[model samples]
Target: MFGNICTLYYTRRKLIFDFLKPGNQCRQLVPEATVDVQRRQRKMTSPDDESRSFFAQTELDSLKGKKAKLARTGTHSHVFKATMDSRGNAQVAVKLVDLRSRGEYIERFMPRELAIIPRLDHVNIVAAYAIHRTPEYVAIVEEYASGGDLLNYIRTRPERYLQEQEAKPIFRQLMDAIIYLERLHIVHRDIKCENIFLDSNLRVKLGDFGFARELRPGVDSNTHCGSRPYAAIELLSGRTYRGNGVDIWSAGVVLYVILTSYFPFGSSKDEVPAIIKRQRSQSIHFSQRLSGEVRSLILGMLHPDPKKRLYSRRILAHPWLAETPHRT
Candidate 1:
């Protein structure tokens, strides 16, 4: 019963700024020592025709005005895409926040997302290039994966499921990324097909860091923010829990969906809770497509009790992940 997922894209080309052409380039601040985005943004406080035109010219022009479908909407933030330079091919994404109202939420989300995303450097994790803070909106520029997302791939498959050969390597990469995040004490609270992107090589690139959080010693989260169908029981129960457990639970759902093109509990949104309730009390019904080993792994990960859930390292060791040697 999880809600729909959203995605965005951008790309990199050893970014080099040419401030001499200020008219051609929007403000950006790149870090010297690390990937943390540093940018010189122009803050505007008025909506005069000149202001509107200035923003219109600068905002749209910076992104090369190639807007893809907006991935998400907030009280103040709206995600969009555009070319970063004249290359037309060199793209960067931006999330424009209407700072006049509902800016507080963005203020909170921006810093935390910025803090965690840049620190991660993994083949499976998406890369962030720069952050532009303007008075009107805070735009985050990042890599663009033209291969779209995993959901589309799953949906296009026959019966909305991948063959074991197709699912193996993708699942392994996702597992590797999740395990890497777990080791760093970083939890990707949301893990679903939609949050997973594919590169030209079909390599998994985990995106969307808005719900990500770092767990300090003895700390856990109870924010209750996640897609419903893939949500962990602990999260749905409104109890504080480790980020790793929730992620593991979500990953199990992803694995099932990858192998079958639909949720194990059922696809109807309204019936998901009831199905999950039954699943918690009983066990999942296996489809003909799933192998016995695959079913077992899913059961262990989807265990109702977080304490009993199979986490990253164990999942990595699962036989299904080794059934074939692939890109993972």
Candidate 2:
């Protein structure tokens, strides 16, 4: 079993979800008000211009004092709403993660998380623009979504099951992002409804790398981490396993949740552990609303055995996903 040394961090984690969808990259990083153009302004000579480094921590501290919007609080971090001047683009939402309260053990994993965040540039994953480290707090600056998270997105919908038209594009983009991260040897240890974000244009962007890691080649992470309901059998059972399969399993759980607004496994906290216990013998009860193609993909992804779980190649080739057009 994974040790309890880092359990405090796990309890403190207040994971959130997202809403909205778009095909275009979700990275318009300007703030709502006119940002003082003088603070580390990078000349935007062309559309292909590289991003300029963000303002110094001193400037951020000053900006954070004014109109500070506290967006979220998880176990070890607080997300503040802030903005940076990005040339003349519309002022976009920026998220500042305050990582002062996390356990030392969790903090040790942060550098790895921060290292992976900025290296990612995907339409379905949140983009990190800068990092600020102060003795009081370490913060990462990232793209902010105007829309809510996945849980709220599903909850606010008119009905329980989102139409295939709605779920497909978002899931497809998420799959693309995951594939990209896997290629970079990175794994988002935590994949759940709350970690998925959405932009004003309704585009999906995956976020929250506090539990993410970059794996060494052929290495399986020993750290068992992720939300209970969405966790794979291996992580729930406290066994070492391949990160990609674990992620895909969690993603499959998310697919089930969004489709049904209910968990296919255990529904309550006390039942969560039992879900994994039964993962070996009990067959999943699929929603009648699910088509055979999507159901097959979900079953492949949620396979109890890590080695048999779906990978990007098989997932991309799945008939349903392959033929499903992103009409949204």
Candidate 3:
């Protein structure tokens, strides 16, 4: 029976792998044709001249007391760390997305995270201070979290995780962020530890809404967009499924890693057949050191069936949350 199940799992995985391969899939989903046209138009126009004139006229009135300095360069954007913004007189992080170079249609097609961020006002969510758009680039100014992202924090301070009492509050803060996203009908496709930022007080703030998609009242998303290990079985199956459930599954993986410092589904580099077989058969095992409630919560979130998984709101009200109070 076990061997038969393994064979079926391997077959399903191969089908998904074939579907994702370059030439086998339809090109329409890639939007390459649209990008090509936009790229041609961009080359004809004088991008530098347009940017200079636009920046000069804009006058940085909104950024009154702030002094922006280039922080780091991401794959698609340049990050800036600005000192003391006009609104809160607090440090802010700004991301400048170079649309002119990437292609004109790319900016338009790219997710309007600024529009979505302002609509979301939660203690556990990173606040969008201001948005500036020019012909060359689209800039988003947001509150800076001094404590940095969860992944970096974990790497620097592995001892913090050993203190379950301290970690409880942080977990609760993460739950708050997830609950808020669910209420907005937004599913954060990527919910890994790296995406969760921490303020000076160590309060959680969910960042990077690039992969997030809004779900209509009765509609569900089918896009397989997220980190591989965090992806749920339904997503790995290459079938259209509710994105919210996938986010819950990723959160479960994050929770497991935070507690045990290891992944539940092994690693992404593992053999495809072995990974699928293990995931399909629900062959996950937790360390004996994990508490009963924590194990139960992780299992609840990692339910194979989306319908059976715990919703964000319910998770916030769970007994584990009651034991750990999250303060803004």
* Candidate that scores best on TM-score: 1
Superposed model 3: Cα runs more than 4 Å off: 1-62, 65-72, 85-89, 101-109, 158-162, 271-274
Error of 1 at 69 (Å): 7.4
Residue-wise C-alpha lDDT for candidate 2, range 1-328, written one tens digit per residue: 1011110111111212110111222222233323333332235566433222222223243333233355776766656565433233322333433343457535677777766776787768876654545344455656678786888888888895587768888788778878888999788978888989888887888998877888867787778777787878888788887658878888898888888887767754746567877676546887677899888988888889888888887887898789655333
Could you give candidate 3's per-residue lDDT for residues 175-248 as a string of tens digits?
Answer: 77877787888887878887888888888898877667787567866676677777787777676776478888
The TM-scores, one per candidate, come to 0.77, 0.76, 0.75
Per-candidate RMSD, Å? 8.6, 12.5, 15.9
Q: 187-296, model 1: which lDDT tens digit per residue?
A: 88889888898888899999888878898657977877668878877776778986588989888989888887667665536465686675577456668867888888
- For model 2, the stretches where C-alpha displacement exceeds 4 angstroms are 1-66, 83-105, 271-273, 325-328
Cα error, residue 327 of model 1, in Å, equals 3.8
TM-score of 2: 0.76
lDDT of 2: 0.65
- Which prediction has more favorable TM-score, 1 or 2? 1
For each candidate, the alpha-carbon lDDT, in order, equals: 0.67, 0.65, 0.64
Candidate with maximal lDDT = 1
